[model samples]
Target: MPERQAFRERIRLEAAERFAAGAADAEVAKDLRVSVRSVRRRRRAWHDAGTEGLRSAGPTSRPKLSEALFTVLEQELAKAPVPHEHDAVGDRADAARARFQSPGPGPPGDRARRGGRGGLGD
Candidate 1:
């Protein structure tokens, strides 16, 4: 983690001293050069919760996708091979150029065709 800024450390230390000496949070705010609401927040966080409350919540995490599910998909894909149709050399060159330019997850029908379950092979 990065070091705390000099101004923030100063404010926290001064505010802590004022709070410990029985000064009102608003008084601490005025003397420490910070907001009254911030003083109250820091006081509650320090007294009621401790250092954890003063720390950032940190980044959110996404659940990991199952490796077993990916293995199952690979197994299914290996069971059958789909036929591919090709045109003349000129058309093939144009198609390759289009593929390089767009490169999208083509159409859903193309996926089904490659999967061997669509009517094209049937």
Candidate 2:
């Protein structure tokens, strides 16, 4: 989980403490730079389930790449490309993906057919 989310949860837990102390939701919201509606909801949760209700759910979804895979990818991207002769593929998509070309001497049509990032070919 990102540090920001954990920090935000800590903030919400703090709000819960304030709620337990009888602080108003609006006051907590203003102090925390959050919506009054959000404070009201948190307050309700604090009353019902206490601190557990305000905890982070951890990651919302599984990552497409694992940490090890992501680290390998970053390392691969950081390496220099092989020496080759090839025409530039596209003005934009090629620019984005140019750093990672196949071992072949030319740009493959695969990206154009499968659709480049942001559907640059489309």
lDDT of 2 at 60: 85
Candidate 1 lDDT by residue in tens digits, 13-53: 66766777899977787887789889888988778765545
Candidate that would win on lDDT: 2
- In order, how many clashes per candidate? 0, 0
How do the residues 22-88 of candidate 2 rate in per-residue lDDT, one tens digit apiece?
9887889999999999999888887798899989888888989999999999999999998975566
All predictions: root-mean-square deviation over Cα? 19.3, 15.3
Candidate 1, which ten residues in sequence have the lowest lDDT sum? 54-63
Top-TM-score structure, candidate number: 2
Candidate 2 scores a C-alpha RMSD against the true structure in Å of 15.3
Question: 80 in model 2: Cα distance from truth in Å?
Answer: 9.2
